[model samples]
Target: MQHFAQYDGEWQNRAELSCLLDILAISSRMDLRNEITKEIERLTKTLVVFLQNPNVDRNKLEQTIEQLNQLNLTLMSSSGRVDQVLGQVDLLKCLAQRNSIPGGSCDFDLPAYHFWLNKPLAERLQYTQSWTADLTPIKQSISLLLQFIRSSASPNTVIAKSGFYQQSLDSSQPAQLLRVSLERNAAYFAEISGGKHRFSIRFMLPADTERPSQTEQNVHFSLHICQL
Candidate 1:
């Protein structure tokens, strides 16, 4: 949705429709609302424990807890799955069915969709907003959860000798996410692979027509092992 908002071109309209269909398909297969509600409840309980610590920021902690509470309530109060409501829209239902076929959404295949895409920007946005309204709670909850998880760990400077690095993970306290940050203009990029017990990173140079090769020189980068 954020990406779809960057332009008002015809291609952007196609992308917006694609995004909506993708979200509906994925959300329909899982009990996303229930899962998010449970996660929020768990996070709120975890945050409440920090309130007793003198070193913690009480104001910020309380605010986050309140936000989680509101999100949880909103999820609980929402009547049905977001996909179920969206599936009722005739255009979207047709789009969903035809989306599996190659070139199935072309102008001749879906004239109504083509016509809708050519609608005025304001009218298109109005319909898009209405279609996405049910998704706001899920989006907000996911964004907040990601914010908390990403900030859970501090970044540490690490060097990959000969463009390779490996580390064993503690099974008792496994990491939820691993983040590697490098300079924007750096010549090489980090390729990371991991499992329950260990992880590895290799810096590789990009190639145009062939497979990328690992850089022989040591690479310095910041790594974050987010456990929360």
Candidate 2:
């Protein structure tokens, strides 16, 4: 969706086509709908427990739970695999097949796709809307879940001595995600790696034509151990 937003004005409609292919590939591998439903259920249960806590904001908690409930209902109403509707579109199926090969989706290889892309912007957008309508539920669910998870943890200032840092994770409360924030103009970037028990971060200098080496200077950044 971000890509779609970024390239919405262009003639190629690359984002729209790529989005379709991504949805098809993802849905073919697993039951994404079921996994999202289960995650929503789990998060909802966790939020319900917070409602009784005096320190937590009841109004906001209730609102989030309500949103989750609505999203859950929308997801439940969406029948079959998420890509089932997209798979029925012949043009998209052909495009997906040709997209796997280098230079395979050229105008000569897919005249139909070329024709579709050449349609008026309004017509192409309308078709894009219809093709992606069924994916709305899953998209909204993921957006909300991520929003909540990211906000669950507050950022803390931490320093990595000699550009390296390591921390042990609590087994009882494993993190869903780890976020590292640095100054926009900083010369170094963070490389994070981890497993269930621990995580490490290394700040490396950017190199254009050579391997990046870790900076020897201490690096300070904001870290968020997001758990929900």
Candidate 3:
């Protein structure tokens, strides 16, 4: 079996094989562990409330919560998409069984799963949307979450093991942008010739940041683990 890399530990030590383990060494390169932890905590609480709420529709609640846990942010960027699809199948089966879906089959169809094997992630999302009717909010929310998951590349875009955002670097001579996708194993990294740079770091700023002066390079920007 292929080993998947993941965020592990309190600070998210990045260890391969245990894709879910926190990455320890990268914490110092950028203050990633410090910043993200809070948001993760917040999301955890939100998930708890969402699941525990007495009034929320149970089916919708379960579906949304399932994706939050099922769509592992770190798994994208690798060829382990099978697991994600399997997770979906499992989710669907559980939902079918619970709702007493008329034709639900728990034995699992190997050929049908194989049919889904080659579908592109984006196409898979579209297929899911088309397969379900649009009347209920539970279906709509779960479908939307699926869209979010597919929008993120399963293998992240970032090629390097870690990312850093340093705004103070001289704009004239620039290094490459390091990009990491939350969707998958796709990660991008930067290589610099020589220099210790002091960076003014910001974490998960609102999308409406001031645009760079026209003179600034219209280069791509990525949020490094340290910076975000």
Candidate 4:
């Protein structure tokens, strides 16, 4: 499931960026410099390879590459201005530590954070907005990539006999991800897994909080083998 894993990773990164943007909105400051820089570097490297692929839309890829290069230049300036801005606000690290404790972040746990929270909402939003501006390019690129990958496949209605289904994959067109859409109120969730040669899906009931058990009844769902 190498292709699936790669697509999953991009999705996860996009989720992380979204979470950061949300947190930044309410807080005056947070040390997300390291995180942003790391992501920028990773995205830059990936985009380089993505741009080389002739199969992808050249116009869109060029636009993304332009945005990435511009952002990279700004962040990598020798003056180190962005680094300094990030160094002053490490509140997120402190808050994360407190959140990991038995109880959530409380005044006694993160007094400094509490102080920041008391600031005017407008001021906090402005500061966070400035910081998150650096991430806009990466976010945009990931969104485009995900949209392209998803649109590459058409969903097929399939039935899982006795809660199980398997299909042999065509090596010529390897899938990037297996998207399974079940009924909104279905009693069970689909557990999908497979490799380059074949794939399988099994509907399982949420037996307990820890693990789900396979269902005995047959299941029906729509499957999309995304390949881009």
Candidate 5:
């Protein structure tokens, strides 16, 4: 294909290679395989917090342990190291989104905007201060998250899923996010499939769904790899 023809022969371009590795990183997300693969990262972080505090809030701490128990189910399919890195990235996104629920119709609320407009300047300033205190770190995390988003970014799913990287995909449509690059690092793409003719990536779907039939190959994705 014309797209892959660009890097068909040269594999030593470090910049190109780095980009490739980063591409592979997000490729895991596009196909939806890595969403659950991020358990190791999540558990390790939670474990640290538990140890540090010695008395983690029981309800919240219990949640981490439960998730850790599911880690094996999520990680069984991929190589340990490769999967771990993806999981760490997902963990970062998870940390960013822990309490916030995902939704749309944002920025400003019509009724609320009118109400705020009627408020005095002193109240507006106080509201701004409160909003900034609560939202600034989450905003910063989102900025960092953008650097890790490789294939494509969808406004719908700001959080990554469960794989080594987090992800959120359309439940009825096989949405794709692909990133192509000439440069990559060998560390990320280890073994190179024992020198295979070509390498591609794919992922598993979440086990439970609202409409099981919807995901029985009805809404899934594939990441095709091309060498140029």
Candidate 6:
């Protein structure tokens, strides 16, 4: 639980970037304005912090900054067009509330949404794609940062006797992420927890709505102590 706290920001941003990319691929334009707005703010803050950090790679930082500047220009030029599209996407709030229900997006539930969906597919695709064009820089930057972080450490095979494992870390070399993977046929999942100086993992069997208990047998898994 504690180790997870360390990379929450990075993971959340990564997830948002991924979701945006997927949504951008579709012809239906759900109101992605809020998501895009939030990600733009997050990326700007991240880029500012990166530029201020002297220890970061200068070459990579320069490339990222250049891309961000171009994206800023795009954003400024398309502000009005983007706003018009956002104004027309008024079903987002209702869609959010009923998303979990089966057949939630039926015509009766959101007639305006159905009307938009009835537009020519090509037009829908064009509008949605254009709306996210200015986000290219942030998408690229997030992808690169995640790749760098994951590649910073190599995976090692570890065994948990009776489904419990613990290890002490060298405080000087702090890990930014902890990855635990097991064989496809394995019957248990790993519950990981740790702090800056140590880490622990408990392998527990799958239990639906019931408390999961640790496995009594030894478990084999791959551990990646990612550092960035």
Residue 212 displacement (Å), model 4: 2.6
Error of 4 at 26 (Å): 21
Candidate 2 regions with alpha-carbon error over 4 angstroms: 2-12
Q: Using Cα atoms with residue i matched to residue i, what is each candidate's TM-score against the true structure?
A: 0.93, 0.93, 0.19, 0.62, 0.20, 0.58
Best-fitting candidate, measured by lDDT? Answer: 1
Model 2 Cα lDDT, one tens digit per residue, 95-204:
88888899888899998888887777778878887888888788899999999899989999999999999999998998999999999999999999999999999999
TM-score of 6: 0.58
What digit string (tens of lDDT, one per residue) describes model 5 on residues 100-196?
4443112242334334434554554454344233223323333333333332343331211222222334434342234322113311211111122
- The 10-residue segment of model 5 with minimum total lDDT is 186-195
The worst-scoring run of ten residues by lDDT in candidate 6 lies at 1-10
Question: Whole-model lDDT, candidate 4?
Answer: 0.64
Instruction: Give the lowest summed-lDDT range of ten residues in model 2.
Output: 2-11
Q: Any runs in candidate 6 off by more than 4 Å, and if so which?
A: 1-88, 97-104, 118-120
Q: Cα lDDT for residue 28, model 6? A: 39
List the candidates ranked by lDDT, beginning with the highest: 1, 2, 4, 6, 3, 5
Worst 10 residues of 4 by lDDT: 1-10
Model 1 segments more than 4 A misplaced: none
lDDT of candidate 6 over 1-228, digit per residue (tens): 123222325343233333443444342354333444454455556566777788988788778656655655544444433224334445544544455588776779868656655565456455446555545544554455566568768899988999999999989877768889899899999998999889999999988999999999998899998865
Q: Between prediction 4 and prediction 6, which has the larger TM-score? A: 4
lDDT score for candidate 5 against the true structure? 0.35
lDDT for 125 in candidate 5 is 48
Model 1: per-residue lDDT, tens digit, 1-228?
Answer: 768755788889888888888998899899999989988888888789989999999998998899999999999999887898565788988988889999999999999999998888888888888888889999999999989989999999999999999999999987878999999999999999989999999999999999999999999999999976
Which sections of candidate 5 miss by over 4 Å? 1-115, 120-125, 151-228
TM-score of 5: 0.20
- Give the Cα-based TM-score of candidate 2 against the true structure: 0.93
Candidate 3 Cα deviation (angstroms), residue 24: 22
